[model samples]
Target: MQGYDRLAAVMAADKGLSIFRSFKRLNAKNLLYLQAEIVNCESELDEIIEEDKNSGDFFREKYSTSVRCLKEGLGDETPKQWVKIRQLRELLDKYNTAALQYAQILRLKPPHAKDREVFQRWLKENAFCSTTAEFNQWFGENDENGGDLVALFGRYENVDALTRWVFRIAIPCFYKLVGYRKAKGDVETGMVYFDDDKIIRATRVTSTITSSAIPATSMIVLYLVNHMAWRLAIIVVYNIGFSMLLGLLAKARRVEVFAASTAFAAVQVAFITNFPRD
Candidate 1:
């Protein structure tokens, strides 16, 4: 049996899906249909108002009470249609968040939408666990695992480019080399995490390449090119590559990338200033 499957079995007993204690997965199409149903019911309510003004009195009283709750809730307004719309909006927000995170996992723009982009996998992975229902949690929430890809893999943390390359290019190349004779379902390139310990290992190897190789090459190039302007040009080119690497592999956020790139540039500037090409 697969190690992941065994690990999953060992995790504490399953409590099943979260519904009574929490919300469930809801589709945008269904939500839209619900809005249509609301409109239909609203028309019925309107007809009731026209037919029996007396029943309308009860609705008015209820509306008045709801308005008071709205005041407490929003501090406050009668709202565009009804206060229930706000609850619907909140539910929509939750679903939008899950869609985006799933997209993040897919490395696709706007996330692999649970509805259509990757509906089958989404159905298998999501909305059942209380811990995973409201959010994608990226790797997911398990009793022992804590969703970091930490267990079964070590403490090293990264969702990185080298592993992604392995999944995207290397795995396919290997299959080709072996004439596609590998066991069926032996490897999967498309996964939420690609969920590998190899990611951590590859991250270290690539990190070493960046840390050591770039500087060594930069030093050699600076020495070979005597012209100061040409040296500055080389530094700029390398800096751009550095920034891109930080973004692609380091998972560095925009500001972190900017700061690190800036610091890297500053170091280059200081080096060129102090140790002129002789």
Candidate 2:
């Protein structure tokens, strides 16, 4: 009886030790996964910043060159002059499209409705030509050389001003958004790290309780088996029932751990998806 008691104690101790070691390992792995995610977010932010800088530089250079070409084409009155004007108009359209894209990437707010309405009214009053038909009508209304050229130059200046306005408002707001996003990422990372620590501590407590309880339970079972010979069969049945219950509990714990990991991954996905990357 004494030998059997020692064997039961050894088995219970071994099971408890194994559970503790496995949980500790799982905690470490979870921490590593969280750290990796944090690093990925940081790298993505750096890439976005670099791409924005390159885009801004490209547009600025192209805008300057386009302005220079328009100025040089001002004096000519040939068919080639009209073709150059058409090409410049197309280029300005492209610039506007690019500027809108830049603004979207920076998450800039649009102008107020009243301001847009006023700007549209001003364009109509000034007979600002956007289409080829409007341009031809305006050109026919003015003298071919002096007034027409001056009107074209004025339109170009207005377009340039609009581009500058978008950049001026969006660029500052972009920097602020970047700062806000970085701070938010930091806070989230800290929260995840803190939660991981708490989980590990809780796991440690569970393991300690499990380790202490297993041996005490085994000893109690051993005493019952020795003192009550007739109830030994009943004790065996109870032991099997308890063992099955422990197995189910361990399985549930594993499922819970997996659920937690999935939840963390979902949080990361939500953050990345919600952020404007344009």
Candidate 1 residue runs with Cα over 4 Å from true position: 1-33, 47-158, 178-195, 216-230, 253-259
Scored by lDDT, model 2 comes in at 0.39
Question: What are the candidates' C-alpha RMSDs?
Answer: 12.9, 33.6
Residue-by-residue lDDT tens digits, candidate 1, 158-251: 5566555665567556666873664353222222222345545776688778767777787778777878999899999989988887777766
Question: Counting only residues 3 or more apart in sequence or on different chains, how many pairs clash (N, Cα, C under 3 Å) in candidate 1?
Answer: 2
What lDDT score belongs to each candidate, Candidate 1 first?
0.51, 0.39
How many pairs collide in each candidate, listed in order?
A: 2, 0
lDDT of 2 by residue, 2-99 (tens): 23243234324322111111122334455455555545655664554455345555542343346554344334532232344455556556555654
Q: TM-scores for all candidates?
A: 0.43, 0.19
Query: Which candidate has the highest lDDT of all?
Result: 1
User: Which candidate ranks first by TM-score, i.e. highest?
Assistant: 1
Model 2 ranges with Cα > 4 A deviation? 1-194, 224-231, 248-278
